[model samples]
Target: MHAFRLTVLAGAIAAGAGMAAQAQPATPAQLAPIVVRDAPHPLDASRGDAYVATRASAALKSQADLLETAQTVNVVTRAEMERQGSTSVAQALRYTPGVIAQYGDTDVRHDWLTIRGFTPARYLDGLVLPFGARGYAQPRIETYGLERIDVLKGPASGLYGQSAPGGLIDMTSKRANGERVREIELQLGSHARRQLGFDLGGQANEAGTVSYRVTGVGRRSDTPYDHVDDDKAFLQAALAFQLSPRTRLEGTAQYQRIVSDGGGGAPALPVLGTLQPTSAGTIARSRYVGDPDYDRFTNTQTFVGYTLEHRFSEHTGFRQTARISDVDTDSRRVQIGLMASPTQAVRYAWAFPESARAFQIDNQFHTALTTGPLRHRVLAGVDYLRETAHFTESQLNILTNASGGYALFDPYAPQYGDFDIATPPDGLNIDQRRSQLGAYVQDQIEWDRLHVVLSARHDRVRLDTHSRQAAGTTTDANGDINRTTFRTGASYVFDSGVAPYVNYATSFQPVPGSTRTGAALRPTTGKQVEAGIKVQPEGSRALLTLAAFQITQDNVSAPDPQNTRFSVQTGQVRARGLELEGKASVNDSLDVSFSYALTDSEITRTNAADTVGQVGNRMAFVPRHQASVWADYTVRSGPLAGLGLGAGVRYRGSFFGDLNNTHALRPVTLVDAGIRYDLGQASARLRGMQLALNVSNLFDKTYVANCLGATGCYWGTERTAVASLRYRW
Candidate 1:
């Protein structure tokens, strides 16, 4: 029934589903606002906190043109995460482009990354941030409550639904806007790291139609290893209304708490003193393998969200979004078992405790149409999600029998007190449940400069598992899945701005446990083929993109080689890539960004007849080359006016941590620096004060950040320094 019918010409996330353009307030049958004079995109609503963002309502939910949305979208804006002082979300994506933000080692709970070669999917605003079955309950948000952070690359399950074909990461909190900001900050560096942060927004009346925002942060930290502790508490609150002109609303609440190590156990060391070198030499990057009065970790998170909008007949309208979540996790660690030589190691005491709950919802319908010269945009939707989790774990290990082994450890020379654990007999339980349902539709077309898009989606997934053992024994399991996805694209725009695009996408993932012969575990399919070229040189505010892509994934889940401890699902993987990027302001005292990437992952198929070459190898930590560049400068007038300077460089190229390709990693180059000063440009009692300094790996290099085999090696990330003081109104 394509008779839905015409006037939503501005797009606040209609079809791509980030439901936007204020997400509220539109009195019944609203119309009258459609201005297009020599417009090629650039409709209205110029970013909430501008730093050059030409729309990415999660990519084409609409404000269009990140080169007419053919895919490969990326934005990190809240002014590029405060000009790269970013503390988390993988350091604000480390200059994006085919991402790989901190893989394996320097773990800060979770935000571990990879893209273009698996593990992407994570969103919060457009839902789906659910991770079940419990593993420390995964929740860590609070990059100062976010305001931007989107990255959509390949395969999005036709419009989001059980993703991962190397793409997806949403985030975008910090709501209630019309732009009236207030800020505060206090931070102290290195390991004694201390912090306090705040952001406030306004407009609660005066015909402003109501709006409010509050963001917070508090922290006490220490972690470069030893005893492992990093503490934090965060809060968020938002509200917005404007009910009528057709209807609008917004609401939010959030809270978070974290206490480290929950078996993250400081990089979880081993590989004989980190990648072979320990004869008591090296291996001291703050070393501490658990035991400061029995090592512990805690995590707690709570969230509530809402968004609504409506319009009945200027052409058609309706929208909705909802969320609810809760989680609590606790962990105890002593972990590092087995080495027993070279420099000695053998210990274990691990314990896990968890709880979780979640709910999600999304609904939408929008329409616009034209006949003669061709123009149409349509969207349809449905979504649902549910999750639940409960967990229990305990382990204790020590070798030598006759009187017993007593957890001995000695990374060169180290010792600690109070250790004895063997707790496991409360009821010994585990329960997990999951549900998902989705439906989708989309069509966006125009024929002036020629642009076309098509979308389709369908999904159903369910999982349930239970276990109870304290001697009595009980076990139950279930899994059901179904999927359908597709996407297609084409673009051509020229007015001296250039655009050339081509796209194809598909993805689906669902693999949750079992297969050591217990069966179950199937679902992993992917596809991608892309080609791109985009540039905005007409008036030059700068935007350039160049891309090439290829990807394939199927079944995954390897290692059986005829029963080598059982595990199978017939694996296959392949990735091909090339990306080049540039973002620039180039004037008003220069600002620049650059990126480059080339990946070549392959593990084309596994089970090589037990010969163990694992079929063409290469895919752990996937990196064939990477690059980055950054620049910032401000000093408009004479005498260092409001002064600022920044610098950056990053490169990483060597990788291999498992899957039959013998370990050997060496390739690094990093440098970052920053400085700022502007006491209100020097008068009026420091109008909005500012002072800053930053440093990251500025030459304190000591490598090896991956090695997944012989005990798991890891260590990378050294120099860090920070200083700050800020104020604004």
Candidate 2:
């Protein structure tokens, strides 16, 4: 089956390349080349004036043309996000290729997504968010402060230490870009949502050597889900200074706060919410199943960072980037437990309070030189990360007494009480600190039409954790480990503008657990081989990529045989897939993006008794087939020349909901559409005024978005609409 898929992918690539070659005749004048010594980095081109990007830096950590790189990289420009009226990171990624956005459904606390069936790491600028491990705390970033987002596909541990094999998402914050910026926006939407925001930036000094930018947002909203209200505020400021022609410095600071009703509560039965209405008196779609008194979540985050760049010589340059961040969250909610039948369910109170402080630094040196006919771009870097986290949890017994839950009441008519629970003491569960230091080197060699990239890195990681108990004594769990990772790839560009490439990369992630012998287990390791074709036809603003890959992970944890409280490393998983994506600016009036992915993910081996017979079971939350298409059109050279319209459709194929393949979620399709009118050309006074409206799930479909098991199912969102008015200069 794998061989057949590969053959089909290859044939598609060949046919695409041939069609591109035939579309444009190759003439001497059209193929004429020009070389300049002081051209700007390719990354600068990706931050273009439009929505279509042709270059990115996330894959190589340096400005490079995407067509020349031997990997898949997708760029979501700020223009694209604004056009789609995206309010969250997950919303911005909905149209991106090869990404499963908002798979967690109504969980707005974090931007949950998957890349190629695996969870990818999150990065701010170039530093890792460092969450999702034992007791690690991650911050939810507001999308209003971002300038752009870059998605790099495939394993990247060879450059960035300890990352998932699938890929990573890197966000670039808004900063002073030397262009004057002035914008103000007001938005109103369904569920009584209201927002006010502004952005202002320009030169800060008469000498033109200094610049500054500031962005702020305030929002108050309620979701379609009953009683789930959200209030948020965000502010960001950045400054830039050009000390000299060869030296420059930039600094940034941001603060954000969010108060809301706790995350979404899944249904007690997988089939009750969508497949059938709850048995208790017509469960309205707006019913609130959770307690309104105990449901609350609050989070606060602060970030400060700086970047310094200097040119030592014509052939060499260096940059240093550093950041310090703090995140704190407090949450309490009443969650539904196992269902007794269709209308009755057990409930329990849950609370969690966590805080984390992290610091990171990266120093890199770059040199571009040539030897004979081979041109080389070499990069060497060192990075360090330090994070400390404190967390505590408390549970209220609410399963035995009638006051604890609605044992038989209707789900649509929830009852609430004033009973209050005491907050848990800090450090009652775990306190941990993690530190990592890594050094890496990479070289990109170009000889004619062929390009080769080689990179290697070594990381030294240390963890010190203390488990706390009510008896006042703490147990220390400390460990240190070292690892080496590498990556190599080569690509050749043909006359038809098609580049065929192949790559091999490795990744490692530390797992927090012990064996029966009281020894820390080794980190999980992953390896992958990917081969693909990339095409960027000449004289066209379109890009196409076709790739197939296989990934294997070892040292996965399973239940320990000797000790029931600990775990052992005796499990493995394999994921293989094919992806095809295309993004194009077909003409001055039309733009389109499309993607399709096929993922086959399964647990290959394990020693745990519960999973011994489930080696072939499909991985949880990952669908077998996913596809999406989006297009926008604007009237050109007509009376409605400034008017635009957009529409998209997303499809997710059926898949198992659990690792054991015991339950399956049905396939679903969603539609989205938008309309906008620009008033800039109408009159001098209205030159910068515009109005737009967007709708998601236009058909108001009712379906199960995801099911963790028989008792944990999330309903997809119903139809939603947002309208906005903005003025910009």
Candidate 3:
């Protein structure tokens, strides 16, 4: 089967190239092209743009055409996200293939979704964001400050050390581009939401050699879940300077504060009546298990980074980047246990407080040279990361084994007694220090229509953890792990714009923990084999891609089948899938995107000693079949020339909710719509202004997202509508 697939792929490439060559007249002017165009608005989002982005930088360390990258890469452009009125990074990726926008539909707290069957790491720019591995320390990137989002599917440990095997999502931040721009927006939406945002940028020096950009967003709102609030304040500033013709310097600083941000909102509550029928009655989606007095959550994060670049010549350049990050969070919530009886349940108060301080640096050197008829672009780089953190958890039992002290509650009719709120004492404290050092090399070899990429990386990872119990006695768990990963791929780009490619990549992730006698186990290893074809007719804005892949992961950490409390690294998972996607600027007035994915993911091996009976079950939260289509249209020339309309449909097939495959999550289909009008059409004074409105889950269809049996389940997001007015100068 593998040989046949490769044979067919090779034939397609040859035929495409042959047809293109015969169609285009061989001209000297075309053979030696002049005026190569730079990527269109790749690092900037405020300029004129389209839904389909032709280039991405995440596939390779440098910006390159996606057709020849030989990877399943998706870019969610700023224009596309803005048109849909996306409020979060996950929302922006709704239409992309293989990305589960909302894992269970209601995890508004963190970006808790999967890419290609697994939870992917979040990246800012080309570097890891260093979120804590044991706490609720995820970064909540404000979409308003982003230039774009690039998703690289499959293993990438060859370049990025210790990555999520399913893939990685990198957010490109907005930067100063020496262009005059000013924008401000006001928005109103569901849940009594109100928001204000602004982006202003321009040259800092008359020579246009220096530039600066400032972006900010502030909002306050109530959530559909009673007593929970959605509030945030964020600001980011970027400054760039062209010190010399071949050297440049850029710096950025960002600060964000969030209260009850889309995190842990679902985990704090218990589910019942929603899944089936409970003796208490059906629980409305608006049910809040946390008491208003203890429902507080706060996260404050700050980051500063700088980039220095110098070009020795047009063919060679070196760059170095460094960043410092500090994050802190404090949260309090009331937890509800499964119904003890038909009308009563146990409740408790819990607290999670954590903080982290981190530093990271990366240095790279890249050069291009030609040897005979082959063009080679070689890249060598090294990076280092060091992070120190304190993770703490506290609880006060209210009901039995529960906490702020466990109390008895009735779900059918809720009540918070007048008893004074109790404070939970820290029950567990963990101080951790983690670090990693990695070096990698990559070479892109090009000859005629054939492109080959080879890359390898090695990393040394160390973890030191100290745990303190309620008695104040502390114990340490420390270990060091080392691994090497690699990737190899070859692609053929036909003159007809057909590119067929195949690649194999491996991943390495150090499992954090110690064994019975304080020793490190093995790291989790993963490998993937991918083959795909990408077609983008010459001089066209449309791209169509079809791909098939298989991935296997080994050494997964699980509990000991022999001892439920101890862990062992003897488990495996396999995922195979087919994906089809198309994006295009169909015409001056229309833009469209569509995608379909069929994922077959299952647990292949287990330490039943460890996993109970989940060995052969499907991975939870991942659907077998998913598909979506979206389109936007505008009247280019007419009385309605400034009016635009958009609509999208998304479908997710049924899947299991538990590792044992007991709970079955039903399939669901959702619709989204948008409308925008250029206010300038009504008055010349509003030439640079616009007004827009967007609605998601238009029908308010309710569905179960995740299920853990009769004990609990999750609810999908409810209908949401927002309107905004914006002006740009």
Candidate 4:
């Protein structure tokens, strides 16, 4: 049987088992039970507010307990991030299954993650961050302003409109909920890193009708690379107002500025200096591959958004959300040219001035009702997105030797001179615009232990591109694409607390170009089938889940066989995988999070004679096996009471570097450890004080993190340590 068929068969068997267990006669509820009080805070009572989240809203855009949803989704709560000292998305998802965080390690400025085998879309509070850094730079969100991060695995276009086949990532922002909140933190770390951060929030009036929150961070650090530094400042503010018992409105604003000499790591070479040593002497891990004078990236970003929601009676509600953002960037870099020899290489430089503006809005209506013996919850929404960007690129005149190109006698010791590099009169000037309108509807139905989900969406997308030059403005590409997608799933739960589920989903992405015949190409489409089993023992906080999935993408662009100069849409790729996750509290003092994944990806079909024979090759940068485990323990009673310790291990299998599979990367394993002490238990004066230390790559093991065929390879983060002092009220 085919792999897809096998997956379906397994799901059938699992579902049959669940049905069999449900057939047993109903039993009376047990009378003897002990009641335990929970934390007083509302945040602590909500789902996903604890380290081991049992509920999430990302998968279905509604709060649903994990076992009730058919898809595989994981939520990383704020408490987990604090224990790990995670300052970025990459660090927060380091232990998650089916997510490859920082796959390109070369770009430290961005959260470069690949879910399953493809790049997942990014969302902030359920709104898409369209395009990402594909053309222009965007602001990096501060972790201090986030309440949780959710990863929804597999195709989600049925609701999100445009998405990758792998999955989607959604971040929930921190907002005031009428509770008094105050926190301040100071930190010191390796590389002369220093930082300060604060968060404040409170209710404005005694009636608790108005609430506000503010978060900010400032940091400066010298990186491991020579002449490279990281500096940034960020601020975010939010306000909430309850006009009446049935109506609520919220507003948010954020601003960020950053200046950096380089992105991350040492400049990468080919296999040399990566898998093998440089022909010259060993290449320095801290080598300055770019000119210090010309290498810099500066950016400023601003965002404003609002959300309004109203409830009518007990079963009807409406919500509207809108956001707009602007980003401006100036970047210059003098990079290493092709190596002439082990010790010699040429140099080139380039600069870019870019700006982008984006706007988005979503309106939704939700209702709950019953039809006969079945209960139904329905959601209908309409969303709109508009984005425009302007960019210019300039390069140095290497031939003139006035300001460009360099001749390095020894790569280790570089020479810098006045390189005449500037934007030419005929430099490239590009203006691009994109707009999308989408409508979607979803219905969730339940009867006793059986539940079902169905959803559909339609999208109309327009793309326009123009080149502004000395002569005139020329239209590069302009077209419109329309698509409709769908998703359906079913799950059944047994009295024993075991749930078996299966789902199928479709996705689509608009392409902006034309085909060999000058006809606008259609959107790329993907289909996936997934099945999983979830176990949550009754009366316990422990959870275990296992899932299997297969996905195939079609309408991929490839070289036209009939017309050598054009392209066709006859390409296909397939990915299949198994994932396992377990979260449990071994006791009152110990908690563990563990996960593992096995993925197999391949380019099944394609055009072009040069690549036709390479159809079976594995996709690049996708590890076949990956696993991680983390454990946190606190001393409840002892001389060392109030002390907490955490440790983790992460392992990734080797992977290929390019489509041709010419270069390979070695597998690696890393260790992390952290320790913290709460001073509140020691004295009343220090009631809200705490001190903590965290270290990653504890062994300082040096390894090649990743490599791009023609670009460069990067070394993983070395041993690093940080100490923090925090106070809260």
Best by lDDT: 3
Between prediction 1 and prediction 4, the one with superior lDDT is 4
- TM-scores for candidates 1 onward, in order: 0.32, 0.91, 0.92, 0.90
Q: Write the residue-wise lDDT of candidate 1 on 1-729 in tens digits.
A: 001111112111111113344332335554664323233323223333554565676755545658777877877777666766778888778877788854533666667677876778778777877565755576877787887788888888877788889888888776765457688888888888778787777776678667777777777767677767677777777677767767778777787777774344455677767667865776787787666665667777888877787878665788888889887877777766677777777776656787778898888787878879987788888888898988887535442334675556776677775545454334456788888888988887888777888988898989877767667665666788889998888888777678888899888888765565566677889999988888877655567889899989888887576665345777888999898878777776787888998989898886546476677888877778888988888897887898888888878788787768787677888887888888888887988988887877778887777777766667776888778788997
Any idea how many clashes model 3 has? 20
lDDT of each: 0.73, 0.75, 0.77, 0.75
Model 3 segments beyond 4 Å from truth? Answer: 1-48, 102-105, 261-264, 267-271, 279-281, 399-406, 471-474, 561-563, 608-611, 708-710
Q: For candidate 3, write residues 255-348 as lDDT tens digits.
A: 8887773234764334457766666567777767666666577788998988888889777888888889898887777777666776677877
Query: Could you tell me how far off, in angstroms, the CA of residue 464 lies in candidate 1 after the best superposition?
Result: 9.2
Candidate 2, residues 1-729: lDDT per residue as tens digits? 000010100000000000000012245564567322222223345353466777777888886767778888888877778777778888888766567753434655667777776678899878887462343257787778777788988889999998878889998777675667788988999988888888788777688678777888888888777777767788778778878987888887777877776443333333565455554533565656666766777777888888888888766889888889888877777666766767666666667777888999999999888899998889999999998887776645463454644444346556754546444344357778889999999999999889999999999999777767556756666789799999999999776678999999999888765676668778889998999999877767777989999989899887776666678788898889898888888998998888888899999987766534778888776788988998999887677878999999988888766677766778888898999989886777898998999998999987777766655666777788999999998
Better of 1 and 3 by lDDT: 3
What C-alpha lDDT, on a 0 to 100 scale, does residue 706 get in candidate 2?
A: 71
Question: In candidate 4, residue 663 scores what lDDT?
Answer: 66
lDDT of 3: 0.77
* lDDT tens readout by residue for model 4, 507-577: 98876555655676667899999999998777666678899999898987776767663568877889899
